[model samples]
Each structure stands twice: as C-alpha cells, then as structure tokens.
Target chain A: MLGRLNHVAIAVRDAEKAAKIYGAAFGAEISAPLPLPEHGVITVFAILPNTKIEFIQPLGETSPIAKFVERNADGGIHHVCYEVPDIVATRDILIAEGARVLGDGEPKIGAHGKPVLFFHPKDFSGALVEIEQS
Target chain B: MLGRLNHVAIAVRDAEKAAKIYGAAFGAEISAPLPLPEHGVITVFAILPNTKIEFIQPLGETSPIAKFVERNADGGIHHVCYEVPDIVATRDILIAEGARVLGDGEPKIGAHGKPVLFFHPKDFSGALVEIEQS
Candidate 1:
C-alpha cells in the first residue's frame, strides 16, 4: 500500500539554480547538487517539513530528463514519488489494474537508494507516478 | 516561512476517474468530488500521509484549467501548493526576491478557505507554485 508522499521531482536545466528561491525566499534548507552518473541526473533537494522538493538536471547527453527539460524549457514537475510497503506487490497490483510500468517492469535503485518503479503517464491521467519501497 | 507541502494539484478531465487508481491500487483515501463553481473546478482529493493529491476538472467552459487540459490532453500536474506561516510576509519576500506573483499579487481565499497566493511558473523554473496560510 502507498505510504508517505516521498518527494516531487522537478525537471530543470540547472538543479541548484532552480532551488535557490526555496532557500532564499521560503527559507527552506537546500542541499548541494549531487550528480548521479548512473541515473544521468544532477539533483538538488529543497528540504521541507513533511516532504522534499527535488530539482533535477541532466547529467549527460543521454539523460532521461533531457527531453523533458527540452520540452518544458523553464522546467516543470516531472513526477511524484510515493512510498510503498512492498514495491513489487504494488507494481503487480498496478499492472493488474491496467497500469503500465516504465522500463521492463523491474524496480530500480532510485535516487534515494530504494527500489522504485515508475508508471506510465497516460495510464495515470497524464501524471507520471513513482512508487518507492519504504 | 514555508511550512508543509499542502498538496499537488493535477488538472484532469474527470476528477473522480482520475483519482480511481489511488484508491484502487494505492489503497489511498479518495474524497468525493466537490464542485467549486466559484473557482471553476470540481475537485477530488487523494489523501496521502504527508500531503494530498488534488484531481481537478473544469466546471464550465470558462474554467481556468480548460486551457491546460486542452494543451495536455491526458491531464497533467497543474501546481504545487506549499504552506506558509504568514502568507502576506511570504508573498512580500518572494516579490522582493524578484519572483512574479500571479494575478493581482494579493492573497485570495483558496479552496481550503485560507489565504493563498500563486507565483508565475516562469519565475519558479516553469512550475506553478501556490502558497497558502498554514
């Protein structure tokens, strides 16, 4: 079952620059950008009380978010990650409900080092959703 | 100062149908659709532990989100709302930081019956941000 609303990821051209307002105006603590070459993204986190806002930029030419940033230009909400007690079980349930899991239907080690799976946007009414093992 | 992330609003064609996956697959509590003609939207809430996911549909032809739904046929993440201790102060600070506040730059009574203000997406790296009084 779904647990906490983990974090919302925003695709941007510059992760750190995109998070500056959260630190300067909202007074939220922002983490320094960290590159994950395997994931092809550089991420910056704006730590909030109950959740976090993740700003992600492309780490390489083949980055998964590269097309998203190109399409959005100014950047946009890329996906929402939710915590699940059992990701594999959750994926099976979602598949049974006619949801399409992205990427060969296997949970991958996500940005938070948890097993995670992403669902296709079309099946979820145009919102890409990620389920992370809690 | 910014507090919790209140909710993420997703613009969809049908609020009830859009929230079905959360209830059926994620086992999340989904609220009955509530029409706010004044705001020109019919909203259904998928209650998560840390925050809520709001599914909104246009109420009438002149609804504000009509254009968004038109642009994104499958629906999409519309805005992210964050809670603030003092909305007025927060708005002033955001403005002083060169962020463009949407509309008249004044806090309006939001769907939750609390003062809220929206920032232009361009100013927030292409993501519409809402700040509500906590």
Candidate 2:
C-alpha cells in the first residue's frame, strides 16, 4: 500500500556536489544533512516544491548504499518512499502478499525522524520501497 | 527552479498489478491511466498522500524506460521529475557544469502534458533526472 510520496532517495557519490548540482539546477533548498547511524550513512535532504529529494552517501565502505553504488557503478535512484497512515498494517499486507520485508522487526527512526521500513527489491519488482508513518 | 515534484515514476512489469498492489495496500485511488504515444508507453498514475507515484510499462521494445527495465532485469526507480520555473535556464546551468544533456534538441510533451527534458546519467552520476516546466 502507498500513500503520498514522502521522499525520493538518490544515492550520490558526493552528497555535497550532488546537492550543489541539484540546488543550482532546480533551486532546491538544502534543509539539513542528517546522520543515519542505524543505516550507516549521512544524508542531506533537499526540500523541493511538494517533495523532498534525499541525497545519501555511505559513511563506510560496507554500508548498503555504498555497496549499491559500487554495484551500479554510480549513484542512482535509491528508493521511493511512501507515506502510509499505518506502517504495521501496510507491512502486514505486503508480507501476506509474498513481499520480502527487509525489516520485520521494527520501524526504526529514519533520517527525517519518521518511522520507516524498507521492502526488499526482490519482492517489489526492481525498486526498493520505503513505508513511512508520520 | 522546481515548482513541485510532478510525479515519481516507477518502472513496473505490469502496471495493472502494481497499481493493485499499491492500491490495496495504501488505499490509493487509481487515477485515469494515460498513454503517451510519443514516449511509446502506457502509464497508470496512483495519487496518494500529497503526491503521485506513476506505474509505467513500456509499449514497445525501443522505449527508454523499457530498455532500462531490461538492463536492470526488473522494474525499479526509473527517474525523478523536478518541476522547474524555467527549463531553459536550468538546462543552461547543467550544461555549463558539463552535465550531459540527453535531449538538447527540444522539450517534448511528456505523459502529463508538460514539456519535459531528460538529463543524462553520465553527467549527474547514475540517476536520470527529468525537468518539466508546468
């Protein structure tokens, strides 16, 4: 299930440069750079008109985003985040539909102080889908 | 530069099923589906919280989104669309910064009836960025 799009995550090699490119190109204002310790990465949020584009860079070599960049050979579209009213119900529905839940445990505090869970790409075609309750 | 995120485009193998998956899960109302003969694909738009997530399936083999889904071996995040105040100025800035322009010729009417241009992934890392002026 999906709600409104909360944010579109983009994996960038250099968050600063990427932010600049986006800032100059689209006049997106950099809200703040946040450290997502649980995800092992630091991210910058550029607030655009109706949505926020997240610029994510891995803090460590073993970080999942870093590995993804390596696999894709560059930073690309990372994930599409949907704002759901209820995270638990959404997770249950997806799980029942044979979707692979990357986190069956809990919704951790994500970059924007929202509870977020990621669905594995294996279950949802080729895209990593994030469900956030706010 | 950006007015608002017009839509978040997700490449899916089956637009109908993806629409169902998202619809049943998030209670998203499926808007009228549209086909862009110029883009060579049929797409369904599901409007959610405050934004829209587009489920796109290519109509032919030569479509860019079609080729992308094939390269990734699965449907995934296709591109992020940013609404710009002036498409011409935005294009000039990216070009001045050595960004590779995928379509330098002209802005074609995209699926949503807006003039759109695509920026090559080579210039901006691994993501295809589209700019539309409403």
Candidate 3:
C-alpha cells in the first residue's frame, strides 16, 4: 500500500532559517529550496543520510500551511508522506474503506516531483498523511 | 547518522480498533501487539508493504501519550522515529545545539528493544521526534 517514507513534513515559520538551524544541529546541508505555489508554501529539503526532513513555511497568510500553523499555535508535523507504487489504487481502496481524501481528484505532482495525495486527518487519527509515488 | 525510518508513531484512542481499520484499509495485517509500560502506552504494529505505521494508545489517563492526545484534542502524529546507528552521539549533538531532551539522561530500551530518546518539539518545530537505534 505504501512505499518508503518520502519525507517527513515539518512546518516552520521560515524555511531558510529553519534549514540553517537544522543543518547546523545535524551536520547536514540543505539540498534545495523549492516554492510550492499551489500549496502556497516554500520548502527546503534537508536530505539526511537515510531520511529527508523537509522544512516548510507558508508563502503568505492565505496559504493553507500558514493557516495550519496558526491553528496549531506553533508549527508542527504537517503530514507524513509514504511512497506508494500506485496512488490511484491506494486512494480508491482507502476511500472505499471510509477514509476521506483531502484532495478532490487524483494524485498530483508534489514536492520532489512525486505524485502525492492527502488523506484527511480525521480518517487516520489526527495526522494528515500524504501518499506519494516517485 | 540514520539508518532508515523504523516506523512512524501515530497516537490513537484505541490501538486495537485503529489497527483493524488500517488493516482493512491497507490490506495489511497486524504484526504483533506489544505493551510498552514505561511510556505508559500500548502499541500495535501495522506493517504495510513499504512502511510500518504504529498505533499507540495510552494505558491510562496519566500516560504522556495520553496527555498528548488530550492536549491535541484528538490523536495525531505523535512523533516520527528514525533508525540511527548511534543514539548517544545524535542526542549529544542535538542537545549541544540547544535542543531539549524530553527523556532524562541516556536513551533507554524502547518498545521493540531499541534504545530511543525524544527531542522536544520546541527544538524541531512542534513535532515530538524520537530517535532510535536498533
């Protein structure tokens, strides 16, 4: 159903600053910072040895990520993404089993050029999880 | 530094039920249910094809995870755990860089016999992250 964890999404106030802080702490350098216009967030990818930690911040106040950070009081884990071989199949199965899809249609290209879709937090406890395929 | 993502921890009100729901939705089976007394939580491991999702529920109301669930108003992604080769070195480095350690002192044996320690969410945004060495 799922593949390896593509990346763990971390919400931050500033992507560049957070990347620098984390890079200094973990002894790793940031890969590249990309702006996700559709999601209304800018993200910096910090590729660790085995896992990639993404630092995300809203581009503007109207961004959904910004709204999420505001609601949570501080930035937190926005979503956990797992790589899946087939996004449509997995999404269909989950929806059939009563899991709600946050996205309206099929999976779309997400950060890192992978197809991704989100499952509502209500369906899987309170964690907003994303399923992606590389 | 890190090996791979051992698992992603999800806090739930009912581990067993959550396991069943996820199992049905993902077409995966519950590997085994384990009781972690020190964390004051019981967990059931749901191994998916490429990733393992852990369902954790507090044994009692006083449990830290229970308190987290309550504070969040619903169960959410509690912590993200990455498998590391050296928990001690990682803990020391993070602490030296002004990261707070939620667990006192050294890493201890966790649910799966791996030594684990938690870094305070304040240091890494708002997500409680656990590092484990198996």
Candidate 4:
C-alpha cells in the first residue's frame, strides 16, 4: 500500500523565490537548499506539519526541470511523490501492469535518502509520479 | 502550519480510466465517482495507506478543468490540497503576506465537508493550493 503522500514537487526557475513565498505566506519551515548534480536539480523542502512541498530548480542547462520551466515559463507543479511500504514490490507490480518505470528500471537513492522509482507520465495519464520507500 | 498533504488532484478527461489504472497497478481502493455540480467536476479518491489521489473530470463545458484538459489535451496534475488547523486563520495569514486567496476571500465548505480556501496559482508560483481545515 502507498504509505503517504511524500511530497509535492514544483519546478521553478528560482526555487528560492518559491520557498520564500511558502515561508512568508504559510510560515512553512523550509530546509537548507540542496544541490543534486546527478539529478540536475537544486531542491528545497518546505516542511509542513504532515507533509512536504519540494521546490526544484534546474542546476544545469539540460536538466529536465529546465525544460519544464521553459515550457511552462512561469513554472508549475512538477510531480507528486507517494510513500510506499515496499518500493520494489510496487515497482514489480507496476511493471506487470504495463507501466513504464523510468531510468534504468531500478530504484535509486533519492533526495529523501530512500529508494525511489519514477514512472512515466504517460502511464499515469499526465502527472509524473514517484514512489519512495517509507 | 499546513497540517498534512490532504490529496493530490488530477484533472482528467476520464477519471474512470485513471481510477482503473491505479486500481490495477497499485490495488488501491477508490471511492465511488462523485459529481460536484457546484464545482463543475466529477471526483474520485484513490485511497492509499496514508494519502489520497483525487481524480477530477470536468462535468460542464465551461469548467476550469475542461479548459485545463483542453490546453493540456492529455490532462495533468491540477492542484494539491493541504490540511490546516484553521482555514480562516490561514486565509488571513496568506492575505497578510500579499497572496491572493481566490473566490470570495472566505472559507467555503469543500468536497471533504470541511472549510477550505483556494490560493491563486500565480501567488504560489503556478501551483494551485487548497487549504482545508482539519
């Protein structure tokens, strides 16, 4: 079963500005900004009482986030992540259902320091989804 | 503080198809399709272990969801809802921080039967956010 809504991620040209908006408006406690070169993104987590909002900004010219921001211009919600009790099982089941898992078809250590898998947006209609081990 | 990630909503042309996909892939329990005429949408909640994934379909020609689907063609993630301890207080605080709360600037009974408020997408950097009283 899906454990919980892990985090909702937004792709922005400037995540600091987005984080500031959440901080100033909702008084959200935001994390120190983190840069993941391998992921080609800079990330920050706006911690809420029960969940998190992730602000993602492109760290390189060819980052997928950069392309998203380019298409949306004003930026937009990038993806939503869900926590799963067993990500590997989740992956196997999703694969059996004819869904395409992105990347190398294996779990990778994500920003949360947990095994995570990404599903193709097409598989979920349009929303990109991430499943993380809880 | 925002209480929890209430639900991640997706606007779809066919919520049933989406629900079926989730049901098949994750074996999730889905609510009966609910039509909210006032909101001009049909909604179904895929119950997970800790959070909900809401699938929304336009019920009218002029629905904002219809327009979103038109623009996106394939539909996409629409908005995210967060639970708050007090909806009115959250509204006031957001206003004080110069964020525009949509509609009448007052809380209304939402689909969850809780007081809720919608924030302008621009204010939150293109993410439409809903704050619902927990």
Q: Estimate, for each residue in B53-126, the C-alpha lDDT of model 2 and write its tens digit.
A: 78888877677677776776667878777788788788888788777778554788877787888888766667
lDDT for A51 in candidate 4 is 75
In each prediction, how many residue pairs overlap at the backbone (N, C-alpha, C within less than 3 A)?
0, 3, 1, 0
lDDT, candidate 3, A1-134, per-residue tens: 54566778888887777666457765666866788787688999877655577889888667878777777665788887877788888888888888889858588887667788898888878878788875
Per-residue lDDT of A46 in model 4: 93
Interface RMSD for candidate 3 relative to the native interface: 2.5
lDDT tens string, model 1, B16-134? 99999999999999999999998999999999988999999999989989999999899999999999999999999999999999899889999889999999999898889999999
What is the TM-score of each predicted model, taking all chains together?
0.99, 0.91, 0.88, 0.92
Error of 4 at B37 (Å): 1.9
* Residue A107 C-alpha lDDT in model 3: 82
Which TM-score does chain B of candidate 4 obtain? Answer: 0.93
Best by DockQ: 1
lDDT of 4 by residue, A1-134 (tens): 65677888999888888899677766789888899988889998899766788999999877868778988777799888988888999999899988899999889998768999999887887989899999
lDDT of 2: 0.77
Name the candidate that leads on TM-score. Answer: 1
